[model samples]
Target: MAMSDVLDEGPFFHGTIADLRVGDFLAPGYRSNYRPEVVMNHIYFTALVDGAGLAAEIAAELAGGDAIPRVYAVEPTGPFENDPNVTDKKFPGNPTRSYRSSAPLKIVGEVKDWTRLTPEALEMWRERLATLQSDRRAEIIN
Candidate 1:
């Protein structure tokens, strides 16, 4: 795939209102862009392309009354790559680009902020991130 295709064929990241411990791999639900259930909860493994989108989702949930919306980094399993229904789009209420992976993704880790990354988690995230095509590496490096 071309660089743009990699950028677009994302196991794109998304932030949501859920409580999960680091290393937990539970399937989570996120809003979908499709019609009928315009604001439906889709249970799929997912992640943002970068940290900004995750932070934005946490902020929105906090503003909407969720006390502690934790951020988890999602890495898509290989099966999701070829799925035709997967999508990446900007949705209402969310502050950044959001995505929906129709297949289960692994929840590699969680963090209160980018600066709080544990060494182990950071290393693991580096591996997971290597699978994406984002231009936001500096966000995690700092």
Candidate 2:
């Protein structure tokens, strides 16, 4: 089968707000975003590609793929706890709270911002994969 043919095999996945977790994710560029019925904690995401040439293949076929979104996760970097330290003692209204990651996060976001990846983005996929592999270890029990 042609390399392009392999890319066409079906059974794509989808994500929704209910699947949101406090971690990093890499999602395929599909329109059915995991947006939930109701807004909740925000999630961070990255896009994955094999290499520059392979990336081009994915891009070119994007218009024809299943269009089903995909999501993979990794450990989150910030304190995910809800702390009373600075929370308003008296939230007269909804009392709902929200927290966000530190600003000036990274360059991957630039894709969404620019609708394309710059050469600098070349390393992002490799870096994210490495980060995800950090916890893979042989178990040792006594």
lDDT of each: 0.41, 0.27
lDDT of 2 by residue, 1-142 (tens): 1223222221111122222334334332323111212232333222222222233323333333443222322332432221122224334321222112222122221111112344456356445534533534411110
Cα TM-score per model? 0.41, 0.18
What TM value does model 2 have?
Answer: 0.18
Name model 2 segments beyond 4 Å from true. Answer: 1-115, 136-142
Q: Predict model 1's lDDT versus the native.
A: 0.41
Worst 10 residues of 1 by lDDT: 81-90
Q: Model 2: how large is the Cα RMSD against the reference? A: 19.3
